[model samples]
Target: MNIYLVYWNSLNKFCFRGILDESIGEGTHFLIPWVQKPYIFDIKTRPHTFSSISGTKDLQMVNLTLRVLSRPDTAKLPVIVQNLGLEYDEKVLPSIGNEVLKSVVAQFNADQLLTERPQVSALVKETLVRRARDFNILLDDVAITHLSLCWKFVTGGNCQRCLEDAVTRIGSSCRKKEDGRALNSGCYLRHSPHKFYNNSSSNDVAAGNRGHRKMAIILAASSAVLALLLVTATMGFFIRKNVMRKRRERKQFGTLLDTVNKSKLNVPYEILEKATNYFNDDNKLGQGGSGSVYKGVMPDGNTVAVKRLSFNSTQWVDHFFNEVNLISGVHHKNDERRKNTYTSESLRQRFNRDSGMHS
Candidate 1:
């Protein structure tokens, strides 16, 4: 029991232990064996978040998650114990929070709450802090953790801008890569084998309303005609420019391929399946909860351990690659050191005429 030292009388052999008289922050406190009675009160920060349904100024019913951080006032401990007691959170705080949230939300429209979250949160915190002091509680902060509107409105202008930026920027920058994705605040661009497209159907609908596809085709056709005329007018200059551009592109491709080859640690699934004879039971090396390991022989007579990871083992994929990268770095460093040592030893042997004569 958490008992503060209140009044102790040795002559009468009576002790009073209560939260009202003295302040005890936290920890175990031993009381007089029989005469003392103990009363405990928790003095820790309390956090609570609950969903509240409130009507906005625009008559829209919105659900918001109201979060409150508070603690009992150390100076007003006696008042807190005498009046509110332990059931304050259940009986008092929730109702006060609900009322304050409704009053604050009724002042703003749903759009204001959505667009100006910081201002709304600050107002709630200020109002709640003042009110909590009356109940002998110190309010730390208040926040609208989440706000959900009854309906969502998609802006056509934002989606159009996102699509234009992605198409013009990602297409030109990531043209050579087979697959990639670009993300923005409002929309995302996804690339597959076919082409880049908006991940959100809403964005596609919005952009389509502007006739972007038709405009693109029209521009392409017009550009092709213009290019044909220009080439006819300056054939030699255009040809020379195209040749130089092709040469530069070839050099870039070679550099990229070389870099990729250095870190090529992936094996095709189909090849692994074929090498293990379609994961025959006879070729299985071990089996466990996370799936089986198999022994496979490559065409070059090199044996490899192929793991058939379970579908549920997806969480380990990142860890597997991390360990692989670390091991690769260590091996690469060791290879470089060995190469340098061999080169140094060979040069020393070649230059040492005394050692050669002794040999």
Candidate 2:
């Protein structure tokens, strides 16, 4: 029969055939048979107690006494023998314990750890369990055995004094309430009419002040609306004035154009050609009743629309000027009748010219 002592180590797995060496330490090691071999293991759960000082969320120093129970898994013995040689505890346990304690204590304050021991213990246990899981080890329990404040290190005075004062106040109040004379006299239940009336009057005054404030707010809002209306009206008046001024200027320009056209009526054909780009298609803007309107730019950079009338037209130049004057007079009155009449006459003349029907 072949016997073997399989054990775990930090670096490699170890297997000892036959009996194990008794002199070897609490780690996995080899042994031989008959000559001298007895396997001894430090399989017992290791207890580690350490003191750690850390800060809580509120930046207070906390003193913690932590106890950790750490041991390797028996089921993982085969893997441990194959992977890590004997001496896993020395390599793994110390570092794991330190990390677990620090991580657990970081979540709590000194006062909470002292008062709520169960919660702190749960946190420590959870930290150790999670850390050990990665190593294939079992963390039995992590206990917070002791937690206290070092007042001299943290604060100048003793915390016991404050606790004593609170206890004294509670005791006195309880004793006074239990006394028969104090209960019968109703000293604690004394009523004041003046205080009641004053509170009532204050409430009424507050209500009235609220109503006044609401009215003031409403008045202020109305004044703002009125001011806006006045500003809008003033802007509208100025805008209308500007529009009317532009229309008057356009009318005066039209009258001046009519006068210039009249003066050019006696000018020869050659002069008209030089003035209107030889009646070129590029210079033409539109065709109207009297003639074609051409867009022309003078040497002075002024743009003008040149209207060229056809030759041998029966209507004289005076008749066209009279019609233009009549349209301008009605434009200031804002009447649609005169404008419609002018447009109708222009349309009739254009139709006659295009259809080759004279007169």
Per model, state how many residue pairs clash: 0, 8
Candidate 1 per-residue lDDT over residues 121-155, each given as its tens digit = 99888887888888988877787888887753347
User: Which residue runs of candidate 1 sit more than 4 Å off their true CA positions?
Assistant: 1-19, 25-30, 152-359
CA lDDT of each candidate?
Answer: 0.64, 0.56
Q: What is the total number of backbone clashes in candidate 2?
A: 8
Q: Residues 31-88, candidate 2: write the lDDT tens digits.
A: 3344443433455688777777766655666676777777777556445444554666
User: What's every prediction's RMSD, in angstroms?
Assistant: 34.9, 19.2
* Candidate 2 Cα errors over 4 Å, as ranges: 1-40, 78-85, 152-359
